[model samples]
Target: MSERKPVVLVTAADLAPEALALLGGYEIVYAGKTPSDDDIVSLCGQHDPAAIIVRYGKVGAAAMAAAPSLRVISKHGSGTDTIDKTAAAARGIAVRAAAGANAAAVAEHALALMLACAKSVPLLDARMRAGHWDKAVHKSLELHGRTVGLVGLGAIGLRFARMADAMGMNVLGFDPYAKELPSFVQRADLDTLWKQADVISLHCPLTEENRNLLDAKTLARCKRGVIVVNTARGGLIDEAALLEAVRGGQVRAAGLDSFAVEPMLAGHPFQKESGFILSPHIGGVTSDAYVNMGLAAARNVRGVIEAR
Candidate 1:
């Protein structure tokens, strides 16, 4: 008798055929959009998936306990925050991330946001559409000959630093785990980076140690009228403090791709601010990035399953 193929539960159904081809030996199970807590648990119980690829849903202890055969959990992107590591560890399930798979896409998005905020793109578009030729504000700032500080010198941060350096901008990186500094980038302490940088960009993960790292106190340490960019995690900054800083003119502008809460409510205060440019967390969702991340995730699952 032939052995049955192992089942793999995938939350992202739209994965390219190239990615799916990597897991041809496995029986695929697709989960619908915006899967809730119960939905994930139910799928685990019903499908008994040997592995799961989490795209944008949360995976907690309950869902992990539901699948008796689950041996691996792979993230479709760099961030593994949505997975409960503690629970997975206790259950002897291996967890993996697709590092650098979409670094270029994320770095490009971060740079785009920074440029949009600096040039007042959102505000100008609104004014132009309202039949006003308002070129008198002159709020746009130049990127050349200015210093940009990067928090967490991971793959994404390093990519952004290289791009900024090529544009005649001084790049400073702050990452304790970084073994060596790359060329065209200088090392700076957090205090010095925040104070000296005319532009500050976050490419770090959200952990207990640095949650809300850019609160009121840190914002105050920045140079007056500093531009802030966050393409990492939303919990890294305190939204209330950011709003106050923008209103007080302490922060010249902010470009945010993530928020403290997802699907940022329409009634949010930032909706009215021209100094803040926001995106719907589409940093790593490019066509090329999706395929890269999906293939990486497939490889992780295959590695774990084969090793066992």
Candidate 2:
């Protein structure tokens, strides 16, 4: 009799064909889009997967406990915040991430957000659609020679720094754990960065220590009219505080790709604010990045399973 193939569960509706090919030997099971925690746990209990490739929804300790055979949890993208790392460690399950798989795509999105905020692209487009020509009264903020401050100089942050540097912007970065930075990037403390940066961008993972890093108090310290961009996690910012800052003109504009809540609730205050530009966390959703992340995740899964 033939033996059962080892099960590998993916926490999304689909993965790239190439990635699936790489794991041909394993039996793949997918949890549909918008999977709830309960769904993940149920799937784990049913599949008893040897590995899990997370693409959406949170993987809590409960799910980890459901699959005693689970050997690894590999993130489809860079951030592993969605996975409960502590619980995995306790159960002897390895946690890994496909780091830098979406770096280029996310960095480009950050740059687009910066430009959109600085030049009021969405606002201008709306005005044009309304048959109003404000070219005579409007002035766009030129990015050249401006200073851009970056938080979390990891892969995405470093890529953004390079783009900003190329545009003649002075790049100041704050990442305590970063080492061997490029000559174009000047390392600075948070206080200095807040005071001097004309533009601020976030590219760090979310952690308990840094939740609400850009709250009312911190936002108040930044240069008035500073443009803010976040392509990272949404919990890093205080949403209500950001809305108030925009309303009060303390922050000229904010470009946010991630929100504190997924698919932000209807009639959120930011929805009414003209100074805010938002995307549905699609910074890393490009076709190229999708394939890259999926492939990396599959390879990571294979590496762990084969080694054992």
Which candidate leads the pack in lDDT?
Answer: 2
5, model 2: CA deviation in Å? 1.0
Backbone clash count for every predicted candidate, in the order shown: 0, 0
Model 1 whole-model lDDT (C-alpha atoms): 0.92
- TM-scores for all candidates: the values are 0.97, 0.99
lDDT of 1 at 239: 95
Off by over 4 Å in 2: none
Candidate 2 per-residue lDDT, tens place, 1-308, comes to: 99999999999999999999999999999999889889999999999999999998989899999999999999999999999999999999999999999999999999999999999999999999999999899999999999999999999999999999999999999998999999999999999999999999999999999999999999999999999999999999999899899999999999999999997899888888899999999999999999999999999999999994
lDDT of 1 by residue, 1-308 (tens): 98999999987566667779999999998888677768888999999899999996788899899998999999999998889999999999999999999999999999999898888888888888998887775658999999999998999999999999999999988999998878898999999998999999999988989999999999999999999999999999999999999999999999999999887888899989877999989999999998999999999999999884
- For candidate 2, give the lDDT: 0.96
Q: For candidate 1, give the lDDT of residue 256.
A: 96
